[model samples]
Target chain A: MTWLRLALANLRAAPLTSLVNAALLALGTASIVLLLLIGEQFSSTLARDARSIDLVVGAKGSPVQLVLSSVYHADVPTGNIVKADADRWAADPRVAHAVPLSLGDSYRGFRIVGTTTDYPALYAAQLASGRFWEAPMEAVAGAAAAREAGLVQDRRFAGAHGLVDGGHEHAGQPYRIVGVLQPTGTVLDRLILTSLDSVWNLHGEHESAHDNHEHDHDQNPEDEHDHGEAHEHDHADAHDDARENTSMLIRYASPLAATTLPRQINTESQLQAAAPAFEVTRLLNLVGLGLDGLRAFAGVLILTAGFSVFAALYGALKARRYDLAMLRCLGATRTELLWSLLLEGLMLAALGAVLGLALGHGTMELIGRWLAASRGVSATGWVWLPTESWLLLGLLVIGVLAAALPAWQAYRADVARTLAG
Target chain B: MTVLQIDNLGFSYGQRTVLRLDTLTLNEGDTCAVIGPSGCGKTTLLHLIAGLLQPAQGSVAVCGQRLDALDASARDRFRGHHLGIVFQRLHLLPALDVLENLLLAQRLARVSPDAKDARRLLDALGVGEFARARPAQLSQGQAQRVAIARALVHRPALLLADEPTSSLDDDNAERAIDLLQDQARAVGAALLVVTHDRRIRGWLAREVQLEPPA
Candidate 1:
């Protein structure tokens, strides 16, 4: 039998001690591996979703909320900005491209975002089939939204008035699906796109319906018909300043805009400008506090595991003293015995590392599925970080270090004295 | 040929002398017993001969190579190549089965394992059926036989047994002595048995007596 085989047999001799050592190491590794996976996936997905959009300009509110609502479409928009004001900023020399988004409607819990074609260009989203919307009532469905809502080209579906389900449905003003977008692995995958006029027309009808109810309280029902007609004309003649869009996604034309644009918009105008990069960093720092605690917890577990392995090996060494002597009598050199003990420690460590990585990835995949369902953000376990290789190397080093003392004792063991005793 | 020789061997623990011996020699295939009382250092003498201890003063040779002339590692190598030892307790590794214990001896001796030879040794020792049984699972007599098989598996030139039959009844002790001597003769190895049990003296042709120094 090989020395490694002997080491394995030795480990098997005390199943409980070996198992406890391996388990402690596995728990420590799993914690760190889980954190590494989730942290990397979270930040990368956040960064990918927020790419290209330098600043989000919207109604005055929390900068983080604005970024969340406008960039990720994961939350409700703070409020709306006047269409004319957003258009004026879109024309600014500092702005490379500005895509206006009008929110506040949904078809089956998937938001119906009324935006220009430049919005698709923002994500570089391409059509999977069919064509883009050419009219106010024509709509395009994102890949996830299309598959989830069973939307196809030429299918007609009326959007609800609110971003959630059970809102008042615009049954009379149904939209025709003109296209479906390919998956961009971004927030766009969860949205239905339409022209801005579709939102205006839909809400205009609701306002007129409210006006008709007021007429029923005072004037005759015949006046409601004429009043609705008048409201339509007023909507048609209304100045652009009176109309509003929810938020404007702005890209900087030059690096100088990064220094001046947000400050200029926040101070000179009635809009809030949130830089995605800055808000994301602040957001990460806040989450990082909790992550730091977990990291420290994992660190303690790993050190304790190292200690446990050492104790197990050292304890076993005491019991196996006579065995060592017998091996010496059988002509095993001190170095051979030493390496065998080290091999035992390394074997336990390798087992822990493999189990830990498998557990980490499995848990992350489950979490990713839940997040994809609850929030619109996509997080996946399929990604591997480079640092994990270092983690494996570090675990092996811990194995060798944990075995160092016991191996030294085995190396220096006095065979004859031990045998005589 | 002189398979074992010793001259003026002496060992001490600190200032206290543990053992002292005059000249002794055993030729190839010779059988002898070193009989003594408790604390007479018969076990220590066996250890010194096996290269497990460096004597304070002595010239010990096996196959005409002086042990003290070689480095520690070289001595270990020489012992592995030339000597086999059976202790009083028959220290078979509890982890390995009877067969694997013999295989372990060959491996530790840096020789390519000969499973056929190991099996044949076990069979000759009459513990062939217990080849796959763990040391813990075997009876004391069976374990002793397995230990004997392990010692002679590599066919060493010198065989050392310290108190090999001290724990057995007379009949078993005689059988154990007969097995050891017969195996030693088969392998052409000189056998040295150390024990405080004077009963073993009758089984060997030559006898040496050890006494605590005055």
Candidate 2:
């Protein structure tokens, strides 16, 4: 009780230094917590979304790119495989179901994925409003896509080419929003879903108009057609191409299909097959390398903080030499003196650790709210506190050792000469 | 029985010998004053008796236990249990209040003195009103009294004072000497005061002067 009182009194005497130390510890702890939460959320989201699909078949490129484009709707596909090849793979005995996907268009920066109704059932997505697309030009919106673009059922928008800054209007092939999916806390929530025929038709119509413009220039050189005539020709061709299909999404009956089908397709046909689980593992490895680097950096920071604690206690000992000698004169044994100094440091570290925990949790909660609003993902904040407990315990141990070094020095001080001077 | 015994005790820092005492003994309840010129080893002899330092070629015994035979922690423990020390500069911990500073001594000695005893000790020292004030907030004479209160709080068997009157005027010095002596006599402890000042030598029961080393 006496030592505790002394420790508390010492802290109160130097509130500014204590506060500074606590703040630094809090900042480091908060960074570690935030990074851990975000990394866990990202990895778990990828794992959960990739669990349902056994294989993703798309154009030949990076397997990671294929999964990102076909399943997650994150990046553009390398190129398209013929719809005829997709129909052939669906007929294979090992295949459970096949859902075709066409990408390359966007609405307001969100990638528009042209996929079938089978995609929602495969991903186990629930419809929050209306129904899935039933027609060529109709679209189903993910929760994030709908909320971000303010697209309700029956609202129409002209799809653009690619996910770039500008857009080339689809002329007559305007898409009507038919359904909005409930938030799945995955990347799927940020994509626009529609029939693969829509994307293929949009591109096909684009190519036909290019040919028509050249034909018009060759045939009618003297009489120039008005803007309305050219626009009508583009629309007519767009409607005609809307019935043709593009690439397909495949789900295997077992894990063996992921290895067998992609290899078989690449060998037997022009189509490419991608395994989402395999690609996700590769992705995790990439992310893990970065996380390991950050962990090393955090290790250095904690080491520096430990040294700072040692330096602070050492300086305090020097400044308080007379006080220690006085205590020695007042019947305090060297052991008691040393223990009192050690207790002071332990108290400082414990207080800083507790404050760091609160600060980390508070910062995580703030970030979780912002992420939930902007990215439509509810980051789990509770998962980080347990890991932070280990960090706090480590800091406490370092603090004790740091304090002991100075206390030992005080124990060896010459009491009589120190008092005399 | 003698509470403290020093025989042929010699100590030095580097090449110079600062303290050389042929023989000294303090019986229980005796108040002895040690006076000397500047650079004389009066404080060093007190430190030797308090077990704060090792003697060069002789031995110091407090309460029948040889100081040289104990390890650092044991020596410290023995000092806390048996010796009370007052310094010329009045070393009270700046972080602790007057009462807390006094209580710290009892705590280090592991002596459980009650609040009533503390109050009585403070009252007897004439600084009871400053009990709650920090050492820095007290006047010089009040801090000196607090130091005296701290030194005697554990009821040690031997009390060592090193020029405790250096910061006090004649009147305060006389009062401090009387209070310290009265407290030592009340607790039945031997008092050894080392001082260069000669004003309060008559107050002690006996006086010893250290000449030059030769």
Candidate 3:
């Protein structure tokens, strides 16, 4: 109790210095917390997307990119496989279902994925308002896409030419928004989805009919009337054939078959297979390297904070010599004097740690909101209290040890000379 | 019987021998004034007697206990229980108020200082009104009074003051000397005041002069 009183007195003596030390410690703690939060959120998003698809088959690009385009709805497919090759895998008895994807054009920055209705069911996506697209040129927007583009059900918008910028004319074939998906807390929340036939017809129409000399091989001279009728139908459908797709998303029933099917398709067919889980895991490993570096930087910062604590306490000891001498003269034992100084440092560390925890949690909340608003992904704000508590305990122990050096010096001081001088 | 006995006591820092006293003794209730020129080791002798430093050669016995035979920690405990010390510069803790400073002495001796004892001590010293004032706020004379109160608070067997009158004028010095001696007597403790100043010699029952070290 006596030592506690002395410790409190010493802290009250130097309020500003104590506050500065606490602030430095808090800064280091906050950095570590921010790094951990970002890493966790990134990994969680990847894991969530991986769970949606058993396998993702796309062009032979980087496996990570394949997963990013197919499962995460980020990036574009390198190339597309023939629909005839996809039909062969779909007919297998071992295959429970196959969902093919065709991708090419985009609306703003969001990719427009042309796939079957099974895509929403595979992702367990729910409609926030209207139903999924059933006809060609009808569109289903992810929550992020709808909210960002200000598109509601039954609203129509012209498709952009390239994936990145500028709209192109399909003449009269504008896409109608038919559905808006509920927020899925995953990358799927930021995509525009439609049917494959819509994209294929648009591109076919964009091809000039003046180059129709090659079409005569598939026509017969005796079917002149039918050929004339077909040519009239092609002109009527010219607006629908203004756009073309470049990629497809394929899902296999079992992971074992999905793994084998992509290789088979690549060997005998013109398609490739990409596994979302493997690619996402690989991406996390790559990201983990950067997170590890950040953690190391935070460790160095904390070490510096410990050193600062040592220097601060050591400097304060010189000014406190007289006070210690007076205590000795007043009947304080050397041990009591040492304990008092140690207790003061411990108190400062404990207070700083508690404040740092609060600060870290608050920062996470702010970042979570910012990421949700700016990046279209919701960051989880679950408190990792156990890890944080352990960190604080370790810091407190280091701080106590740092303080012991000065306390030992005070204990060994020559009481009489200190008082006499 | 003597309360403090010093025989052939010697102390030095590095090659410079500061004190070499052949003999000194103080009986209970006796007040002795140690007088010498500047740098004459009066304070050194007082420190040796207070057990703050060990004599290089010879012995010091306080209340018939051999202080030189004890180790550092034991000597500190013995000092806290049996000795009162008033430093020349007062050395009051600047963080604590005047009353807290006095209470600190009693606390160090493991004796609880009740409000009554603290108020009584303050009233007797004529600094009762400044009990709550920090040491930095007190004037030199007032700080000196607070230091004296702290030294005597534990009712120690021996009281050692190092040049308590050096910083005060004659009038304040006389008042300080009277208060110190009276307080020591009232607490039934022997007083040893080390000073080069000769003006306060009248307050002591005996006078000893330390010669320059040979």
Q: Which window of ten consecutive residues has the lowest lDDT sum in model 1 chain A?
A: A223-232
| Per-residue lDDT over A1-421 for candidate 1, one digit per residue giving the tens place of the 0 to 100 score | 3888898888888888888889999999989989999888878888988898999999999999999988888789999888666666777889888888889999999999988888888889999999887667789999889988989889999999888999999999899999999988888999999877677678756766333332232333232212112222323433434667899898889979989889988999999899999999999999999998998999799889989998889988898989888988888888888899899889889888888788888888888998777654578777778989999999988998899999999999888889878
Fnat scores for every prediction: 0.62, 0.63, 0.71
**CA deviation > 4 Å runs, candidate 1:** A205-238, A369-379
DockQ of candidate model 3? 0.51
Report per-candidate TM-score of chain A alone: 0.87, 0.81, 0.81
Instruction: Give per-residue CA lDDT, model 2, range A1-421, as digits (tens).
Output: 8778987887777788766766665666666666666777788888877767878776677878888877766776767765545666776878777776667888888888777667777668999999887556778898988998998888999888877537786757799998899988777788888865566557756777433433433354222211112212333444322333335666677767666778898888877777788888888889899987887776666566667767777888888999888677656677777888888778877776777667767777788788889888777566654666688788788778878889898878888678666
TM-score of chain B of each: 0.97, 0.95, 0.95
Using Cα atoms with residue i matched to residue i, what is each candidate's TM-score against the true structure?
A: 0.90, 0.83, 0.79
DockQ for every model, please. Answer: 0.65, 0.49, 0.51
What's the CA error at residue A258 for candidate 2, in Å? 4.3
RMSD of candidate 2 to the truth, in angstroms, is 7.8
lDDT of 2: 0.76
C-alpha-based local distance difference test score of model 1: 0.85
> What lDDT score belongs to each candidate, Candidate 1 first?
0.85, 0.76, 0.76
Q: Write the per-residue lDDT of candidate 2 for residues B1-214, one digit (tens) a residue.
A: 8898888889988989988988888899988998998878887787888877799979999988998899877787788888888877776878778787777788777798556677688898888988898888988777777787787888889888888888778898898888889998878889988989889778899988887585
**Candidate 3 lDDT, A1-421, residue by residue in tens:** 7677767777777888888887777777777877877787777777877665666655666776777777776776666655444555556654565676777677877777777777767679999999876667889999988999877899898777556667585647788999899998877788888866556556545655324422431243223211112222333343223222344444556667765666676687655667677777787888889889988998788778778878989998998898888777666778888888888778877776767667877888888888889878888556684567678888789778879999899989998777667
Cα TM-score of candidate 1: 0.90
lDDT of 3: 0.76
